[model samples]
Target chain A: MRRSMLFIPGNTPNLLMNGDVLGSDAIILDLEDAVSPAEKDSARILVRNALKHLHYKGCEIIIRINPVDTEYWQKDLEEVIPLKPNLIMPPKVSCAQDVKTVSDYIAKLEEKCGFEKNTVKLIPLIETAMGVENAFQIAGADERVAAMFLGGEDLTADLRCKRTKEGNEIFYARTRLVCAARACGIDVYDTPFTDVDDLDGLYKDAQFAKSLGFTGKASISPRHVEGINEVFSPTQAEIDYAHEVMETIRIAKEQGKGVVSLRGKMIDAPIVERARQVIEMEKAMFGGVEDDE
Target chain B: MKITANAVAGTLESSDVYVKVEPCDTLEIEIESVVYNQFADDIKASVKEVLDELGVESGRISINDKGAIDCVIQARVETAIKRAGGNK
Candidate 1:
């Protein structure tokens, strides 16, 4: 039920152990980019131990393992997959085959570890241009993928574009990723807003993210989590409006009417669907904000 | 240790997650709970850190102590964010 996922460096034991203290819908213990080459094994050991020792209820604990192409991935997965995290985020996923490959790896690993095959889910990150282009295929490749995220910082670098604070350079890519995820019926997460000090900017960007149809967002800092959660989530006004629209539609249907009007605005099936989506968004955010329908 | 994402279970004391929108676009969070008091500063700091990290501007926040753990505070903040429409 977490809408904003906070990424804490894997080596930072304080943050990792106390991440529930930070207000993220989920927390990612990063054993990938956040861990330098020297700290790799130590970070993994720390995270694996912490995952075993701590109990962060209500917040999902996801481990972002190193990408399959990396030298450390096999060892990383060997140590991590058995911890039974809420989910596993596979970095730098490029295509359907990449997802299938990881799924196969997890399946094999599960048997070796005596765990249920595919008990854990994957959240592939579309961090590269090729990954973005193949996002749909990647998402649809395996049911083990619970959702997917856009890694715009890396994607921008791969595309050879400078990232502006306004996020102008990646608008097209972001839209494409969202469209791809929605089309495939999987949840889509927007890239993190990097300006930790700029709350207003974060706020505006979050609103922009919501309007773009992303279900959730990533956060480099815990501060961005609430903002992202707030921005991407449906407002009470929006939720209530959605309820009224749906209720009106239900009444119209009860009276055998198809197209109807709510406060003089024409209400139709698309409107009902949109309203239903908003209500679902509200529920996803607040957990209790759902329309009876 | 934290609690599960379960039902309201019991409200120990009739409780609420207090929130006020400031005139200056700051989202002020104050959690009033009969249960908030039993928790330590680390837990309180955890709550404050979430509000601070969440990019709330020009707001004053106070969590009324109730005997809530780290997880409950986190869940309450998430609830506040949702109530505020995740105003982002």
Candidate 2:
């Protein structure tokens, strides 16, 4: 249900106070790139306090800690893990070992805090060339991995290529991540469309990601949340078709028939599954409203 | 705990508080908040709460608040004290 995960700078109190009202399905409190080195300690404390006191209604809380290679990451984990955010996005994860390292550390922290084991899930940011190459292994590395996230900006940088607005360069990475996450039976998210002002471009990019089977898209700007949500949400036509498909299957089942057909075309298992997915998405987005009889 | 050095945390941004801690023989807190008339006592109480939790006995604590709430005040004060290297 994470259609749009908006990144909020960890140290900015103004944004943190109003995060819940921003219309994003999830909000990433960014502690990695958003906060300067000097402010890292301060930002950690601030984020910790915000999590403890503030209630972010109806949005998944994700804390994007610094990469595992840095000195700041462990401190970041120690501070936020106790507060129990919905997910922790480890940036620049390169392989299965990296995911293991974070996961193992979290397991220990969860135990030490007297919380349930694996209470905090991970969404690894596969941003580097090595990460993309080992995306499958990384996604399957630990049971704590709830999803995978593509970092196009860092991936392109690692690939020594210019990241154009058209995203011709990242097409392969996007598809590869989708395949890898799908193989692991986990959700995958696309990177933020960095050009915040271009709504048309955002829509196109979101649609492209959706077509490639991305579960959702991340956004650095609040302006893109509505558009991303719209792109990922099931359309009225799709909802209606899914309802018709389900109705057709119900009638066929009542007739004790092994075969089912919809609109003169055979409706097989794959089609039925797709229809259920569409219906599920519709319910999640629209509060499980019953279809018109 | 004793404040070992001068340290500052937070910023003068809106909905935030800038906190500074310095070594002193007696604990003293000075606050200048945008909402001083309404929430100054609550802000002071928040600062004292963090200071007491950190076992801070003596320091010159100064705060420049820009309409920050209790949690923010507590966080900034705690951060400033920790950055000051309080000897536990």
Candidate 3:
């Protein structure tokens, strides 16, 4: 999961172009809520052209299309999915069956388009209370589903509550979303910090979200990407400590020692696993070289 | 320096080297030549590292193997990137 997924309003070409230049690991060309219905088709064409032509190396491209249940969805899918983006973030996914529908269409489209089967994944966003209740079923509906994102502002509106600074009102929903995703073995992403100028606030919120096991957060502004990445990245100190712990364990095992201590802390199963996860995440987050098989 | 070549993945009857320069979003240069299996993996890694070090991460990259030397591989990639206005 990326530390921050930068979202570009679908109608702005310059914003789309800056997505790669601004250093976000992933860029979402949003067509659903950010775009007005009057400009939705134009937004689709713009996003399609960008996907087919833009030079965004190593940036995962996600297109947030309109809800599948809407009248415009099929055309949106037909026009954009063929471009073969990294993933499609379907909004307002209500159940297992909802995701399955998109998954089935994607499979057929891959065959028809001559792209690799299952090359594109689905990110079903839970934006309503009903969707939150059905989160597990929705997340597990497709094998190609990668992550579930909490769409808080929309969700709050649906729930008819004013969102709080600490997000206390949405705590239950956030925890529920995380549990559902984890139960189904998928990643859960937190909603963006809407206040782009509030860098400290964004960092605090992102850190809090990370503590709660949300893998990453979304960003509304390009400026937010750096801060989010900073919060999520393993500092050199952490990385080095993890490496030391891992090496100590390996050495101790080679020496046939049942127990090992590194810097007064016992090296054990959980610690070793955490270290390994850190390493793996670093590899995933950064474009580490993997031999093409 | 100008480069023009294309490569495909398959066995080569004799050792051959083909190169090309095309517009690539991420591929800097790709070399497709038949190489000894024992050295193929190492050669690919070395070439990728060199390209990465040179800050050429995006472009059309296609490599066809024909059992070339490390020197030949370096020369070919450098030649191709230079043709694409990359630092020679």
Q: Fraction of native Cα contacts kept in each candidate?
A: 0.00, 0.79, 0.00
Question: Which ranges in model 2 have alpha carbons more than 4 Å from their true place?
Answer: A290-293, B86-88
lDDT of candidate 2 over A57-153, digit per residue (tens)? 9999999999988989989999999999999999999999999999999998999999999899999999999999999999999999999999999
DockQ per candidate: 0.02, 0.66, 0.01
Q: Write down the lDDT that model 2 would get.
A: 0.92
Question: What's the true lDDT of residue A184 in model 3?
Answer: 91
Candidate closer to the true structure by TM-score (higher is better), 2 or 3: 2
State the TM-score for model 2: 0.98
lDDT, candidate 3, equals 0.74
Q: What value does the interface RMSD of model 1 take?
A: 14.1
Cα displacement (angstroms), candidate 1, residue A292, comes to 2.4
Model 1 chain A: which ten-residue window has the lowest total lDDT? A284-293
Candidate with top lDDT is 2
Candidates 2 and 3 compared by lDDT, better number: 2
Write the residue-wise lDDT of candidate 3 on B1-88 in tens digits.
Answer: 2223332211232332333445555455444545545776777685676567666666575555565445344444544555455322
